[model samples]
Target chain A: MELTIERATKLQTKPNWSDLTFGTTFTDHMFVMDYEVGKGWYDARIMPYQDLPLSPAAVVLHYGQTVFEGLKAYKDDAEEIFLFRPDENMKRMNDSCERLCMPTFDGQFVIEAMKQLIEIEQDWVPEVDGMALYIRPVMYATEAHLGVSPSKQYRFIILLSPVGSYYAEGINPVKIAVESQFVRAVKGGTGAAKTAGNYAAALKAQEVAEKEGYSQVLWLDGREQKYIEEVGAMNVFFKIDGKIVTPELNGSILPGITRKSVLQLLRHWEMDVEERRLSIDELLEAAKNGTLEEAFGTGTAAVISPIGELFYKGEKTVINNNEIGPVAKKIYDTITGIQSGDVEDPFGWRVQVI
Target chain B: MELTIERATKLQTKPNWSDLTFGTTFTDHMFVMDYEVGKGWYDARIMPYQDLPLSPAAVVLHYGQTVFEGLKAYKDDAEEIFLFRPDENMKRMNDSCERLCMPTFDGQFVIEAMKQLIEIEQDWVPEVDGMALYIRPVMYATEAHLGVSPSKQYRFIILLSPVGSYYAEGINPVKIAVESQFVRAVKGGTGAAKTAGNYAAALKAQEVAEKEGYSQVLWLDGREQKYIEEVGAMNVFFKIDGKIVTPELNGSILPGITRKSVLQLLRHWEMDVEERRLSIDELLEAAKNGTLEEAFGTGTAAVISPIGELFYKGEKTVINNNEIGPVAKKIYDTITGIQSGDVEDPFGWRVQVI
Candidate 1:
């Protein structure tokens, strides 16, 4: 796929990298492509970052037929830009499109286009200690119709935002509330796909958790509300009785690349890890027995977010005495080290963009 | 509550009334308003029908933080426009907004604004049998942020489209497929809200039903998948053993305006109507016992769609000899007649716009 580039006549001054927030300040350019029913993906171009002109009757606005992917581009000490596991994100994005009845494109071709777009806006990659250029790729139905069917027309766009560290103060552990109501996804639902509706369905529960003095929600299974599914937008893990356990992908949990890497790293170091159904009762029992060693969440945004406390049914259990455990610290350091090119990448996860 | 009117300088030629499809052609003007956290709802205006300029990172694009309402404006023999219970739609739209954590607006003020918009585009209300101007009111988050929270900025816009009859050939019965796998809405989900995500979640199942030679899918309960919840986007009704029965106002079913009208009409005529849980097994048993008289769906678009045949788990049950039953025909005529000003609306359900 050949990509045409158009430079912007003017550019906005970059913000202070250290004081930046996530997904607010954008770069100078964006990449866009369109898809029609008869014609596949066409007219891939890089243009000035601007507002999109859309009809009020667009299918995406009324039916939520849209999917998105999030990743980051980091700059090493030598000013080289690199992307961590973008191919995995692309593949997952296709999975989301299939669930939403939207068309999918070649992942390799889009990854190549993403690389070209990142090269053009490489200056936007922050050079701070924990800051990086957050990349957002979105695909939505642009058909100007009101029917409840798959849209015949689609638009795929890539945007770049310079983001600060997820935890500005440091990698502090957060408190999570165990949600007993308002499920995010079910077995036959669009839970595994990173679609907009899944996130939309999660906002209400998240709001309730926030009002109750919690940072995120620990979602239970939709049917029984017994098994632990996910924690806010991340995959959760618990170290109980010297065994690392995470919930199996039961068609309702997002398959996080960071979660996969964490598991791989654990196994590489000869640690016992198991992926199966982990019930909330079992976890609370382990906490009561004082065998729950460590609990953390893994995702692209914050590589490792330690869960210091869990509040369920008016009961709060503090984990690791409200501090980051040794296992979480090591995993965070290893992942961040590999990402910044400070540690040896034995897994070949990072791909250089420039 | 003041609405500023800005007429289009150049209006496009109106499409042929007979050639129009639902929500495909727009009028010359549209209604728009904005909402801010502290400012409330303001900047109400009627301007030329045009494209909306949206940011690439708009909250509605990434997260499904949007709600919408669908109603219609009818034209009588005097060329006057009428709206069928628009106040109820505005009220329900507010309910949907509350569920999605979006702000609510005054229903009376929006109803007045809708009236003004409809009056300005009175010519767009087609003067044909079973044809009217479809009104779409949508509210969505406009904040350009990636965080999972309610947006501080929102846009509420109303667009009008002249639509042909839902049954262009005639008011014929349609076959429906019982969906035993995919669930539409669970008890704590957003099924009661007229939100975009709910509709997006049903598209895949609808596609599968269509491919199986069915007009729509009859959704069962999300938890047990035993009791019937809804049919496509409409609330369903059944006449069994000389009783008119429809599903109760469960949390996972849309409380359709037309469904309400149908119940009221049945009560007015002294018919035995019941709003309670009707299980699929009970319905199939009634069919087997030759006590199932009629089955139909109620909504704003089709008004009343009779169910001729139901396919469930590889078994087919034909109803009323695969034709429009007497009770369904009467209900459809009564609702359509009341809407078109041909019958007396004793319940004061019609609102005159002009």
Candidate 2:
């Protein structure tokens, strides 16, 4: 588990904390490892953030054999950094790697490397209440070939970016367009894996939604385009008649880490929760019947993005009068509180890195 | 569309023609261009073959917003080079770019650039009877951002590889597995585009088929898994009861240039060809009745590959007595003859580069 270290000779000036943006400014260093077919994973090192010299014929650039994971490092008032459910992200990353046919590594070793990386760049963790250092771990096929197969060479990298809140409006409920035109992923596709292709498949629909004045798109099942799958890059949840309901992980929905935590928190509080096939028709009916109490999206970027409006087939459904519902607010507060070390850790989900 | 040229100072030794492989060796130079949101496509140049310096957060690596086109440059006995329907490849590449939200350029300009690139490395074009220089043009998002949206910057690159026949066995019929479990693309998915994600999604199935002693997989439709869509990155055609049949372009199958050329050639030869849905059940039924005369796959890489046998659900269907059928042989010979200047170019599909 020994890691090589290389310090930067010159460091760039950090961005103003008040004006930080997502994924734009990065820390001084990054962690990297490479894997060859016969050599396995080797050359683990934490070096200064630099451009990767890649072949023009690299498989990742041509076939999209890449996977990534996203999580954030939080700093509380005590100035200690914590990672929320990083082990879960590591496990999910391995799952994504397996789906993409890339090599998998020991999650614990990688987590330890991430901890060292975070320790060295501790100052980059923003002090703002809602802001944290965004950590991105990515793996891609590096084989310089044109064949449509798994790569024999691979590279895994971890980069850190100083960030602001995901939503520019700061957790205000967002308008979502229920997309029925473009399908994201099918049942037998790579949807369940956090692979690059699923996100690429989603860009067009997201663009259309944004053009229509919606912040994100609500994706339905690829087969029928009827059942709700996810909202944008997050797992979606709806509160109907005092019960929390989310679409079950049916091999096409990404098993989000935040979604898992929210469900756990709800179950711990003894709330009625159900994970099942939730259809858009049923949701619209509930909205019409005044039983759709709350709706929100959960992800690493935006812990809980309350959905204020849903546009489906030229019809709009306003939920909770365009306000954050009580349930969403509670879930958001409890999760963020635990992440920032302000609230008691009942679930013990937070891992201290620094 | 003026393209600047930069010659390489040192070139690597060319691989022996006898030992040539697919997509591994490279030429002395490559074509490259860049695109910015408002600046449009610019900086077109032919430069020495070298590694591309990419950022860790490049959108293509994380989101898979990449597309590519494959064509080949053939050398005739008279020392002249020809490109088979390269204009079609350019047009399809633009279609792919539009689908991925990347900027599209004039097809003519890109084709001219490709020609110049080919002329610069004309010696790299193999003179072997079955060998040619494989040309690959790729476009990918280069914007270093973490959000799941279209990239504001992109890179378009073209690299050349001198290779032998796609099948090391020299166009011999090979075994294929009918995949019912894993789906490649659906109607609303990115199946029609020569994008990176679609190929990424097909790798697992291809791997499984390879493990089952098959060279490729016959992918069915994503929804029902009933109808045939494609075969191992190629458009498939079947000769059922002496009629040439292929899956229609229903937005879920890549409109292969080789496939189109073959259809036109068949029509010119006064053969009955139909573009319609051909289900596996019907194909198996035809096999049982001894009406399935031939089955072949068409693509840029493998111009025509004969399917010797199909394994589906533990049942094997041997086509044309596990040999290259008459129709497939004629089609392959006609196409290759036209490409290599051994046959009349009545279809005007050949573009003379030098």
Candidate 3:
């Protein structure tokens, strides 16, 4: 495949990385490709990050025919930039495209494009503790048609943003509200795909969670609303009776990369890990009996967010001393270390960007 | 509430009404309003049809936090342009905004803004047979944030498109495909909201249906996958034993305006219209026993798309002589007549735009 790179005419000099916030700032350039009906994805290039000249009838503007993926780039003390298991994000994005009826792109081609974009925008990567360059690859329907059908033409673009830690005040435990009225994903829904619609559906519930003084919403199963599915943007795992118990991938919850890595590391360390449908009753009972020692959420951004208290309706349940559990801290540290190139990547997960 | 109106600086000559197509061409002016965290919604105006300056990190770009509502403006022989049940669209749009976490605008406010926009672009309203001005009201998260939480800002805009009948030749029977592997909406999800995510999620399965030589996909229940939910973009209705039977509003199916109107009409006609869970087995049984008289889909774009053949897995079922069914024609005629001011507004559904 041939590629073209057009540098931005104007580039930011001496970016104030210390004042960076998540997704507020962007680099000078971006990656874009177009896909037509008969022709597949073509005209792939890296160009200046600017506004897209979209038609008023673009499918994404009306039908929300779009999908996206999120990953991060970490810089080590040795001045090396590495991406943690970016291939997972690439594969997940393709999966999302497939579910959304958008054409899928080659994982390797997408990875190569990301590597080039990251290399060009390396200066924008923040150099603070737990701060990294947030990479977003998006696929959208660009066709100027009004029909309720899949878009024939699509646009694929990758943008980069530098940001601080997810919580900003270090990895502190967060209070979460369980919204019984609103549900995130259903069994046969697009929950497994990292599609935009899934996140969009959760926003109102997140508002309710925030109004209740919680950081996120703990989403339950759509059917019975009795089983714990996941947190807002992360996967839930519980340490119960010396065994790692996490909700199985039942087609409604996103299989987080961090969740997978932790499971792998735990299995490699010969720890008990079980993936099954975990119910709220079982968890509360375990917590009451002292079998549930720690509960946390894992994802690309937060790494691991400890659960201090879960506000189920109006009642609150405290968990494991209301602090970052030792297990979660160890996993978070190991994953960050490997991504930042401080520790040896035994799984060969990190890919060098520059 | 205070209101501000900026008239369009540029206007175009009206196009031929007979040449209108669904969502192809827009009117001269559009309504736009911006929102920020503390300031709320501001800069409301009716400006010329143009592109919006959106940042690359806009929440809708990545997370799909968008929702939209569709209605039409009809011009009677007296040159009166009226909107059909716009308050329904307004309520649905706000419901969608609540679901997508976009800022909300009042029903009367949006209706008034749309009235002004349509008034400015009134020349674009089509006078030809089965042609009208298609109005699209969209709300999205405009915040330049990449976080998964609810956005602190939003943008609401309404665009107008002059459209002809969906099927210019006439309402012909359409072949349908049953999507067993894919589902449209799930219980406790955003299926009821007029949000963009639900439509985005349905595109893939609809594409598969089209590829299989079907006009639309007949969505099934997300959990059981045995019950009938809806068609590609419209609400499905079945007539059995001289009674209209449609799927109940189960939080997973879009509660369409046309569907509600059909129900009201049926009830007013002293005909039984049942809204309950409908199973595929029941439909197949009815089809086999010659009891399933007809089937059709209802929406604003496609008033009634009659279903002739339903391809389920490998089995096929033919419905009602493969023609526009009597019930469908009656519902369509009544609804269209009321909309176009040809019949008495018994329900007071039509609201004059100008």
Per-residue error for B247 in candidate 3, Å, reads 2.5
lDDT by residue (tens digit), candidate 2, A68-130: 999999998989999988999899999988877889999999999999999999989988888
- CA displacement after TM-score superposition, residue A327 of candidate 3 (Å): 2.5
Candidate 3 lDDT for residue A40: 93
Give TM-scores for every candidate, taking all chains together and pairing residue i with residue i.
0.98, 0.98, 0.93
Give lDDT: candidate 2, residue A71: 91
Per DockQ, the best of the predicted structures is 2
Q: Which regions of candidate 2 are displaced past 4 Å? A: A167-170, B167-170
Cα lDDT over the full model 1? 0.91
C-alpha RMSD values across all candidates: 1.3, 1.2, 2.5
lDDT of 1 by residue, B13-33 (tens): 989988886778999999999
The TM-scores, chain A only, for the candidates as listed are: 0.99, 0.98, 0.97
Provide DockQ values for all models, in the order shown: 0.77, 0.86, 0.64
- In the range B1-354, model 2's lDDT, one tens digit per residue, is 578999999988888987876888889899999999999999999999989999999999999999999889999999999999988988899898878888898889988999999998988998988789999999999999987789999999999999886666666888999998888888778999999899888898898889889999999998889999999999999999989999999998999999899999899889999999989999999999999999999977778889999999999999898888888889888888999999999989889999
* lDDT digits (tens) for residues B130-155 of candidate 3: 88888888877767788777778787
The list of candidate 3 runs beyond 4 A from truth reads: A1-3, A6-18, A166-170, A313-315, B1-20
Q: List the candidate numbers ranked by DockQ, top first.
A: 2, 1, 3
| Candidate 3: Cα lDDT at A132 | 93
Query: Which scores better on DockQ, 1 or 3?
Result: 1
TM-score of 3: 0.93
Residues A216-238 of candidate 1: C-alpha lDDT, one tens digit per residue: 99999877888999999999999
The order by descending TM-score is: 2, 1, 3
